[model samples]
Target chain A: MIQAALTFAVTCFALALVFNLWHLARAPGVVDRILALDTMVINAIALLNLYGISQGTPVYFEVSMLIAMVGFVSTVAYCRFILRGNIIE
Target chain B: MLEDTTLIAEIVVSVLLVVAGVFGLVGSLGLVKLDDTMRRLHAPTKATTLGIGGVLIASMIYSAVFLDRLSFHELLITVFLFLTAPITANFIAKSYMHRHVDEGDLPPTEGPYGWAVYDAVPEDERPIDTK
Candidate 1:
């Protein structure tokens, strides 16, 4: 039963992944693309969790945590780039 | 070996998982279909906050009830996401406005520290133009 649900979730979030990438493709500006990428990270996290449930492994949870941290940091960096001329400054 | 109560719990987790997926898809769809940048911001904020919560909650329940080991790791992700999403949104909004919007549309500067000039020197840091 839980395996069926995991399959459904993986499919659903895959569709979301396509949408996010499409948005990234046609984004009118940098910020729009950033938003799309940020969302893509979120979707990926969901997929990771669902996969973990499917496999009954605890390791995927750690991967998901690391992805979450990286996503937030990258979003901040992108916004900082736009707000300032350079990322490091 | 499956008990009736465990069956009900499994069903509940499945429902939560499906709900999370649906919310996530809708939010990403909003990003694709929305015509404006500011409007697009609303979509992912809803997705990241609500959708993530549902999925993580399902994870927590599954680990605790099925795996027989109490799990609060999902809570760390949840709390971190909630705190970060708004902050990232704010910075993105500021970046969007700074680049796309006109200066006249921006709010008045509190001092010489113009928000429009965020990349430049602050009000105090700028060399006094003693002209």
Candidate 2:
């Protein structure tokens, strides 16, 4: 049961990654592209977590955490650049 | 008793994983299919966050039950994500507003201050130029 669930989830999130890439490639606006990229980061984090669970190891925990932090910071920075014309003032 | 508990644990974790995947897929689908930018913004912030939360919770439960150890690190990620998700969304919205939204389109704030992105400093409050 656990194995089946893991495989199902891994496939779903992988499909989600593809959807996000499609959005990124043909996004109508810059903000939409950024949003797609942000979502991709999130999906990647989910994928990492699922892999860790299936493997029964805690090794991916810190990696996901770091990716989450970096993704948030980058998203905010991109938005800041668009809003203020500079990332840091 | 031990066998039953293990079965229950596996079942619970499986359900959570499946739920997370569904939410994740739906959220990304929304991102692609939504017609409006603001509407698209609504999708990932809420649904995707829940998806990530589900996976994290499942991880915690799986670790506690199957691995015979309690893991709290996933909780840190959960908390950090909850804290940052809103801020990220806010920044993205603000940027969107800055680029695409017209100040005239929004209803007035009914306060002395204007929207933060568009508000201007009064002459008296301007920083003194030293150069």
Candidate 3:
């Protein structure tokens, strides 16, 4: 049952990759591109969690948490930069 | 035994996770492929938020099944992410419009939906989408 779940998760990850590729190919404007990148970060974290389970290791959970945090913080930082025209004032 | 029930639950959860990943990927692609920032914003809003969410739920199920413990960590992060991603997108778009419109770099009607947020920008620094 667990293996089944893992397989499903992996398949989804692949699907997300395909869609993200599409966005990269067709989206216009930096804001749109950045938005797409943000989605990538989120999906990547989710993938990490599934990975942790597939391996039956607790370590991946921590990694997932870290990825989530980093993705959010980076998006915030980037958005701020886009708005202010500078990362640092 | 409880094991059988757990197995069933695991299967269900895994299915959910797969669905979520599909949504995430689709959203990401939409974001990248769409033309114009406004159009691109919709992709992440729909797919990524829900897609990552689906994966989180799967993780939660996996942890609960094998570890035989309740886990809520992924849930918390999902909530936080959903809340934040849109706000960030909105801020970026608004700011971009603000800068461009103020400087008359773009006509008031140039942006999709006819954004005039650029009116909020300072005159000198208003940006024009040169690209």
Best by lDDT: 2
lDDT of 1 by residue, A1-59 (tens): 88787777788889999999998998988899899999999999988888887777888
lDDT of 3 at B6: 79
TM-score of chain A of each: 0.93, 0.98, 0.87
lDDT of 3 by residue, A1-89 (tens): 55765676677676776676666566555665566667777777777877776776767767776877787777777867767677777
Taking the tens digit of each residue's C-alpha lDDT, what string does model 2 give over B15-105?
Answer: 9999999999999999999899999999998899999999999999999998998989999998999898899889889888999999999
Q: Candidate 3's fnat?
A: 0.72
Which candidate do you rate higher for DockQ, 2 or 3? 2
Tell me, per candidate, how large a share of the native contacts it keeps. 0.74, 0.88, 0.72
Q: What local lDDT score does residue B73 receive in model 2, on the 0 to 100 scale?
A: 92
Off by over 4 Å in 3: A18-27, B1-4, B99-131
Q: Could you tell me the TM-score of chain A in candidate 2? A: 0.98
The digit string of per-residue lDDT tens for model 1 on B24-61 reads 88899888888889999999888756887888889888
